[model samples]
Target: MNKDKVICPCRKLTKGDILKAVEQGASSYKEVKKATKAGSACGKCKKQIKKVTKKALKK
Candidate 1:
């Protein structure tokens, strides 16, 4: 995935941000949301956020 790609437009968060959050110990969507504020607004990105989070944690 493109690290620079904005996965969450509401927070302007990129895939790298989510990966970084996971690397920093965010093991779930909830934690990622709290850590990076990625899917906390509007909620449209929640599904994508969960997908990213799950994929990151799998690695």
Candidate 2:
């Protein structure tokens, strides 16, 4: 994923932000949401957030 790509436009968060959150121990969707507030807005980004989170987990 592109680190510069914005995943959650609602919170202006990028994939890198979510990845950092994952590295910080956010393994679940809810945890990533709580940590980065990625999908807390319109909810459209939840799926992408999960994908990014899973990708980060693989690393």
Candidate 3:
């Protein structure tokens, strides 16, 4: 994953941030949202967030 990639522009969250949340046991979109405040804004990044989480889980 791109370390500099900002997944949630609304909250200025990055891919690393999302992964951190995932590493912390956030296995779903809702759980990631609660952990990182991502996909909580305009909702544009929700899909990407889910994708990121899924990728992480696959590993």
Candidate 4:
């Protein structure tokens, strides 16, 4: 798995998808979900998404 690539794994969301969500103003985990529909299913991607979201916003 790519460290910087945020994959939902469950939903298979790509790093670009998460990055775009962050760029679109998804600062929080829940907000990211709304923006990308990533962690909405299964919830397995919650931790990964959260971590990447944090890093993406800082960038």
Candidate 5:
């Protein structure tokens, strides 16, 4: 995925943001959400956030 791709439009968070959060110890969707507030708004990005979180953890 494009690192610049916006994963959470509600929070204007990009994929890079999530990856950085993962690098900073956010190992789960909930943790990522808490760290970056990515999916905390409309919640529509929950699925994408979870997907990114899982992918990041595998690395």
Candidate 6:
């Protein structure tokens, strides 16, 4: 897990954190943030969150 994948560029959440939350069943922007503090910052990671959520939902 790269601690530098930058899941949320705004909140500075790495991919590992986000993916971990996803694995735990976080299926939305709010869930991601709540689960891993990913978008609790400037909010620039909205796009990335949505994308990850979409992918996660597919699984």
Q: Mind giving the per-residue lDDT tens digits that candidate 5 earns over 1-59?
A: 79999999988999999999999999999899999999898999999899989998998
- lDDT of each structure? 0.92, 0.91, 0.91, 0.81, 0.94, 0.75
Model 6: colliding residue pairs: none
| Candidate order, TM-score descending | 5, 1, 3, 2, 4, 6
Better of 4 and 6 by TM-score: 4
| Model 2: residue 56 alpha-carbon error in angstroms | 1.1
Say which candidate scores most in TM-score.
5
For model 3, residues 1-59, the per-residue Cα lDDT tens digits are 58679999999999999899889999898999999999998999999999999998889
Candidate order by lDDT, decreasing, is 5, 1, 3, 2, 4, 6
Candidate 6 structure, TM-score to reference: 0.73
Q: Give TM-scores for every candidate, taking all chains together and pairing residue i with residue i.
A: 0.95, 0.93, 0.94, 0.80, 0.96, 0.73
Question: Pairs clashing in candidate 3?
Answer: none
Which candidate has the top score in lDDT? 5
How well is each residue in 1-59 modelled by candidate 6, as lDDT tens digits? 35468777766677767777888988787888888777767777778777877776787
User: Per-residue lDDT for 1-59 in model 2, tens only?
Assistant: 57989999999999889989998999989999998888998999999999998878887
Show where candidate 5 strays beyond 4 Å. Answer: none
What's the residue-level lDDT of 24 in candidate 2? Answer: 93
Clashes of 3: 0
- What are the RMSD figures for all models against the true structure? 0.6, 0.8, 0.7, 2.6, 0.6, 2.4
Q: Look at candidate 1 and give me any clashing residue pairs.
A: none
**lDDT for residue 52 in candidate 2, whole number 0-100:** 90
